[model samples]
Target: MVPCEDYLVSMIDLPDDSLHIIFHKLESCTDRNAFGLTCWRWLQIQNLARGSLQFKCSHRSSISDNVRYLSRLLGRFQQLNSISLAGCTELPDSALTQLRSSGSNLRTLFLDCCFGITDNGLSLVFAGCPALVSVSLYRCNVTDVGLEILAKSCPTLERVNLSYCTLLSDHGIGALSRECLKLRAMTISYCRGITGTGFRGCSPTLAYLEADSCLLTPDGLLGAVSGGGLQYLNVSSLRCWAGGDGLASIGAGFAKNLCFLNLRLCRFVGNESVGTIAKGCPVLEEWNLALCHEVRVSGWEAIGSNCHNLKVLHVNRCRNLCDHGLRALQDGCHQLAVLYMHGCRRVTWVGLESFRMRRWGVKVRGEENVSVGPSLDQFFL
Candidate 1:
């Protein structure tokens, strides 16, 4: 009889197409590694099949060795298109420099919380990687100088995330917006230095923008929204209020395509501006107005009547919300699927029960903080 090992290998061998399909089905890097080590056939399949690589560290460690290891792996995996180096707090600049020579076909690169990368290192990396399409430097040491270099180097760049990069001012962002015409998505949340003037006549293709917890005034935000292609916008916790008119301008410009809007913790925004948004953005699907104490039934009624496409509504911690508002929502917004109304003190069980009975299919989630305190009455039979 033939050797058992040889027979097993022959029997288990899969065609190239079948092996490729199996490799495509595998998502976990650990699984891919195990599959590759199974046999010589699988090793060859893994080499050809691998396209994206991610290095995520949940705990802090010296990633200098890991980066060197990645450089060596890049030689083996020539088809790599994306790489993520997130949570590697101790990663040095020199490691990124090595990546430039190895990652030639790289399209996407994420350097989240890699605090060690300064302007010099990033400049070197960007100089080598011209094919990069998406780049994220979330909480990195990258400054205006770094961004300016990136703008000049990477022309095909589209999506960029610069969240919590404290040193970057409008000068860097302005340069980037002007240089990278193909740029669309931007997440610059917690970037206090960025003023509205930086985004004047910026990318016409820009769709998603998030600048929450920034020092942007209503005028600054309004300028950014004027791009006329914004579909999703979040300017929550703005340093100052520019009144309802600023938001009204945004609504007018983006009414046709705007779908998701988050104005949570925007204490200064009142019913007037929100009402305007509701009327203008008729196709709105999701809205978050949490802690907006000023909004009453009038705003809810407007949203309910005009925003028929609205599916998810978050009015959590709105102490002013009452039965009238809930009833208004029931009258309109038939497509509503999820509702969050925690800390709606004025809403009694009777009103909630009635609304629940009306839209029995909608998932209503929240805990009522009845001033009457915890008692047997809290439970509705």
Candidate 2:
């Protein structure tokens, strides 16, 4: 057998393709870095094998370091697919311009909390990267013009998160719906300007939609999702305008396959609306009705008997909930694995304890102490 030094030398001389196969086996970033540091040959091979990179610019030193490293990687790796610059506060538009100049066929890009990325810089991104499939601009300064440019440029975009993009309005959303036919999941939470018109007459290819805290009226929702197979829907906090009638419309028309629904803080939602949901969504598995005070014991009874597939229920801060409601859930929802009832004033220790003692009881953290049962965080864990 050869000596240890000779074996080391032979390993370093392995073909580029073989080295790339070995790199794929290294799961952790630290392990890959260590392997790259073994020798110059391995480092070159490692760079070639790389497909994703994340840069966080916290301090001045990190910013400079990231710039230099990114420049080198962009020059070397043409196969880069994913890049995240989340929380890179100091990163300027110039850096983004440079990244786009690399002409990488980027599939996923996250610029969340990158405060420096303006419309001009983002315009450069959309213009340069047409192959982009997923893009997030959470808390960025991107406006309607940038969105318009994005819609016209990237036709293949599937997922987009414009959460907290306060400047974007219905015009931008309408453009996206009209142009990006392949778009699947969209998160427009806190974008108040987005009304139902954006989705009107557009294709119903969207499966996931999170439009929480928006101005989407019930009719607008009906018009927007008329044809799609929407599975996950979060229209929570619609100023209570989309009440039972609105929910009923959704259940009857758009969301037959709906599994997850979050109507948290929808103050207008009562037993009538929830009853509609029970009858409409037969496959519903998770429901979040936190702070929906109008839903009483009758709603719980309806859910228990009708929504048999529901495995997770969050009814926190529902002031009207009492012992009767808990009993309804206990009797009907046999598949329930998680239940949250914190801030439910009428549900006392006695009612909660009896359920915990039974075989069907979920036995979540707060089950041990009937009076002050578990907090909301415990159920989530």
Candidate 3:
């Protein structure tokens, strides 16, 4: 393992004012105990800093009262900008409720995957967090009524990720979209209750949208105003947009300037849409074309020829990709950092009768050339 000194030496000599900025990036992100005990300087970094204080618990730890406890601990640094107590099964409502009035500077909050969280628990955040800008509630049980209250209360909300909150319907979306003109990013994945009507009314300035596993239709995907800026989109696993031409419409209308595109598991992405995306999105960077059963191997070649800036390519469970397509990506997309090609059964390097070479692929029972593909990370999930 690399030493902390080595890592510290790699970074530029940060000033006192900028140290807080750097500390904000590390204090909540880096290993907590290790970062706290690094040195007196490292320990003091967050003391004077005033940005965000995240108290997330991955395990089944009970920290309801602890949230307020930490606020008291950091009473002097009142410039706290955000707080996230995710997965704290025993987190008390009283402790969190008081933070609304106390942590006045907080702008963002993420309570993802907390099974124990209820409507009343979130109501505290909605009522308290007046200046909130972003919120993520993945796998949490925040219903439409609670979300409706949140939309009505928090006016500064811009980015929201409510993936897996299946109960939130058009009523919730309707209420929120009424005021959030500055909203940029949102994720309603697996929220089958919301459709095109819900989205069109809510987000006029939406740029980043991820609605995977939802019931959003083609009209819903096109709900954004023509002039409205919709850049990054990920709308995979929709049963409504399953036709070949429907996928093409998405390429022609919505995906023109999409920088990040993840259309994995979309039942209708074939050569037509693939070809259109390669031609449309010149500045495309990250792309996930995994589980697209209908997409032909030639589509990747077109993408390689067009999107030169392509970095991450995921082709998981695409059983149709052959050596021809794989070689095209290998030779064309030089900037690809990760390539996921797991479950692509047709992609093999077996000597097809006459073809012979010393650098044959690794001996795998099922996949003839599994070893010949990209790294394992590039190959699968």
> Highest TM-score: which candidate?
2
Model 2 TM-score, all chains together: 0.81
Per-model TM against the reference:
0.80, 0.81, 0.66
Tell how far residue 31 is off in model 2, in angstroms: 6.5
lDDT of each: 0.78, 0.78, 0.66
Clash count in backbone of candidate 2 = 1
Model 2, 130-205: lDDT tens digits are 9898899998888999999999989988889999998988889888989998887788989877776777766667
Order the candidate numbers by TM-score, best to worst. Answer: 2, 1, 3
The model with the greater TM-score, 1 or 2, is: 2
Give the runs in model 2 whose Cα sits over 4 Å from its true position: 1-15, 25-31, 34-43, 61-73, 101-104, 201-204, 240-245, 348-350, 353-359, 364-381
For model 3 the local lDDT of residue 1 reads 92
What tens-digit string does per-residue lDDT give for candidate 1 at 137-184?
999989999999999989888889999999988889888889998888
Question: Model 3: what TM-score?
Answer: 0.66
Stretches of model 3 off by over 4 angstroms after superposition: 1-51, 55-78, 113-121, 201-205, 224-228, 239-245, 297-305, 323-381
